[model samples]
Target: MKKKLIQYSDGYLNRVPILQFILVTLLFPLWGAAASLNEILITQFKVVFELSDFATAFVQSAFYGGYFLIAIPAATVIKKTSYRVAIIIGLLLYIIGCYLFFPASNMATYGMFLVAIFGIAIGLSFLETSANTYATMLGPKESATRRINLSQLFNPIGNIVGIILGKYFVFTDGASLESQLAGMTPAEAEVFSQEMLQRTLVPYQFILIILLVVLLMFLFVKFPKTKPETSKNVKNKVNLGETLKYLSKNNPFKKGILAQFIYMALQTTVWSFTIRLALEINPNINERFASNFMIYSFVAFFVGRLIANVLMTKFKPTFVLTIYGIIGVAALTYTAFVPNMTAVYGAIFVSVLFGPCWPTIYGRTLETVDDKYRETAGAILVMAIIGGAVGPVVQGFFSDMFGSLQLSFIIPMLFFLYLAIYFLSENKNDSHVKEESKIA
Candidate 1:
C-alpha cells in the first residue's frame, strides 16, 4: 500500500503540464525580487529623501497597499476571463509601473516613486492572485501544497538576486548621506539627492527590460487548457456577498488569513529594519556593507525553503510550519534581549524560519475552500498582505517612540508566537479529524 501511494503521487506529478508549470513558477521569483528590492528601497529612500523611519515605511505601505486595492479586481478579471488573460494583464501593469521609474527619477520626486511602486504592486497583486491559485490546480489535489511549495522555492532565488543588485548597482560608496548633507550647500545637496535618486532607478531599469521579455512570453505562448475538472464555466459568476458570507464561517480559512497577515507583518518588519538594526549595533559600516547581512538572510531563506520542500513530502505542512514558528519566536526573543552583534545574527536567522510560512499557510488555507471559491478566496488571502504595509509602520513608530530598533523587534516576536500557536492548534485539529475517520 505504501508503494502504491508513492506511485499515485508520482503519477499525479507526471500529469502536470511541464511548460505551463514552468511559466507560472517563473512568476514566483519575479515577485520575490520585487519584494526584496523594497527592503533595499526603504534604506535607500531614507537617505535620499532625508525621511524619518516612519516616513520610509510608507514605501511598503504604498507597495502593499496596491495589493490590497487591486486583488479583488484581479479576481474579478479571472472570473470574467481566464487565468491567462489575468496574468497578461498583470504583466502589462508591472511593465507600466517599471516605466514610471524613469519619470520618477527625472523629476526627483519621492511621491512619484511611491506612485510608481504602487503601480508595480498592482501588477504583482494580479500575478499573485492568479499564479498562486493556478499552481494549486496544476495537478492532483493531494499534492497541491507540495507543488506550491516547490514553485515558491524560486521566489528566494529572486530575493537573493534583488539583494545582489541593490548591493552592487544601487548603493553608493561614500560617507553617509546625512553626514555629507550637513556640510554641503543646499544646491549641492539637491544635486547629490538627484544623483542618488537616479542611482536608485538603475535596478528598476533592469527590472523593466526583464518584465517586457516575460510579458512577450506570456502574450505569445499558448497556455495549456486547464483540465475540465479544474476549469470554471461561465455560469459560475462570482457573487461577492455570498462568497464573503460563506468564507466568514470557515474557521481554518479565517485562521489562515490571520496567520498570513501576521506573517507578512513579521516578514516586512524583520527585513525592512535589518540594516537599521545592524547599523545601530555597529556604527562603522556603510549601508552598502550592511546589506551583506540582508543577502545572508535571503540565502538562509532560500536554504530554508529547500529544506521545507523536503520536509513537507514526509511530514504535514502545518507541523513543519508550527516548528518553524516556535524557533522564529525564540530567535526574535533573543535578538530583542541581547542587543549585540550576536543578536543581529539571531535576527538574520529568523529569515530561515520565515521561508516556508507563506506558501504553507496559503496552501493549507485553500485546501479547506471549495473549488468555486478558490479564486476569490485567494484574492482575500492576498489582501491580507496589507500586514506588510501596516507592520513596518507600526514597528517604525515603536522604533521612533522608544528610540530603539532592538525593542521594536518585540512586535514581530509576538507575531511569530501567534503563528506557532495557530499551527499547533491546526495540527491538533487535523489529527482529531483523522482519528475520527479511522474510528468510523
Candidate 2:
C-alpha cells in the first residue's frame, strides 16, 4: 500500500489512499510551524528597524503581496514540473528567504525584511499549491475532503511547535537584544540585527540538511507517478474556457469555491485583527505576550485540524463545515462585540471550523472536475489563498478607517455566514455523502 502511494499515477493508488494521505501529510506540519513566524517577524522588524507598528504590519502585507503574485505562477510551475521537483524548488526558495535575512539585517532596511518575507511567502505558495492537490489525489472523489482533512493534521501540530520555537529562539524579546540594537549606530544596528536574525540560520540549515537526506531517500524511494485519467468524464485538455466552464456548470463546484473564497477572506481578517485586539487589552504588549497569542492561535489551529481529522472518519466534511461555520460566526461576532478574554476565546474556537475548510474545499473542487483537470483544479484551489493577502489588507484598511480593530472582523464573519448557508443547503440535498479518512 505504501509503495502504491509513492506511485499514485497508476490506478493502484486508489487501493491505498490512506497511505497516500500519510505520505503527503509529511508536508503539513511545516505549514503550522510557519504560523508564528509572521507575528514574530513583524514585531522584530519594528524594534530592530525602529519602524512604526503600522510599518511593521505593512511588512506582513508585503509578504502576502508576494504570496498573491507568486501563487498562480507557482501553480503553473507545478503543472509543468513534477510535484517532487516543485517541492524541491520550493525548499530552495525557502532557504533563500531565510538566508536573505542575513543581508537584510546587515542593511537594516525594513524594505529588505519585506523582500525576504516576500521570498518566503512565494516559496510557501509553491509548496501549498503542489502539496494540496497531491493530498486530494489520495482518496475517492466523494471522500476527498476527509482525506485532505486527515492529511492536514500535522500542519496545525507543526504550527503549535513552531510558535513555541519561534517565540523562544527566533524573535523573543529581550531588553538586552533591544538595548543592544538601540545603542548601535545604523551600521552597528545592521550588524546586530543581522547577527540576531542569523540565529534562524541554524534551524533553516537543519531543515535543509534534513531535506537533503530526504532527497537522497527519494532517489532510492519509489513513488508512483500516474498520469491523470485519459478517459475521464471531462476532456484531458485544460484551457481557460474549460476551467471557467467547468466551474460555472457545476453547482456544487461553484458553491464550493464561493465558500472557499469567503472562508479564506474571513480567516485572514480574524488573524490580522487578533493582533490589534491583543494590544488593545494591554497597551504595553511586549514580545512575550505576542508570542503567547501566537501560541494560542496555533493551539486553536491544532485543535481545529485534529478535530476535523477525527470527525472526517464519522461525519461528512460538509456537515463538519456547516456546523463549524455557524459556530465560527458566533465566535467572530462575540470576539468583535464582547469585551473580555473569555469572549475572545470564542474567536479561537472559530479556528476549529476554519482549519479544515481550506483542504475540504479543494477536495470538493477535485470532485467537481475530471481527473484530467486535477492540476488546474489544484491551481485554482490554491490561488484562493490570495484571500489571505487581500482580506487582511482590507481588514487593516478598515481598521485604519474605523479607528477600531474589533470592527474589522465583520468581514470574516460575513464570509462564514455565506459558507454556513452553502453547507446547510448541501447537507439538505444529501446528494454527496461519502466515506472519510479513518486515520484520525
Q: Rate the local accuracy (lDDT) of all candidates.
A: 0.86, 0.65
Error of 1 at 143 (Å): 1.0
lDDT of 2 at 65: 67
Alpha carbon lDDT at 378, candidate 2:
67
Q: Candidates' TM-scores?
A: 0.94, 0.82
Q: Candidate 1 — which pairs collide?
A: none
What local lDDT score does residue 15 receive in model 1, on the 0 to 100 scale? Answer: 53
Could you give candidate 2's per-residue lDDT for residues 182-221 as a string of tens digits?
6778888877776666554444444455445544543454
Q: How many angstroms is residue 418 displaced in model 2 relative to the true structure, after the best TM-score fit?
A: 2.8
Predicted structure 1, TM vs. truth = 0.94
- For model 2, name the residue pairs that clash: 6-223, 6-224, 7-223, 7-224, 9-226, 28-155, 32-159, 33-158, 33-159, 266-412
Looking at model 1, residue 257 earns an lDDT score of 98
Worst 10 residues of 1 by lDDT: 1-10
Give the C-alpha miss distance for residue 166 in model 2, angstroms. 2.2
Please give the lDDT score for candidate 1: 0.86
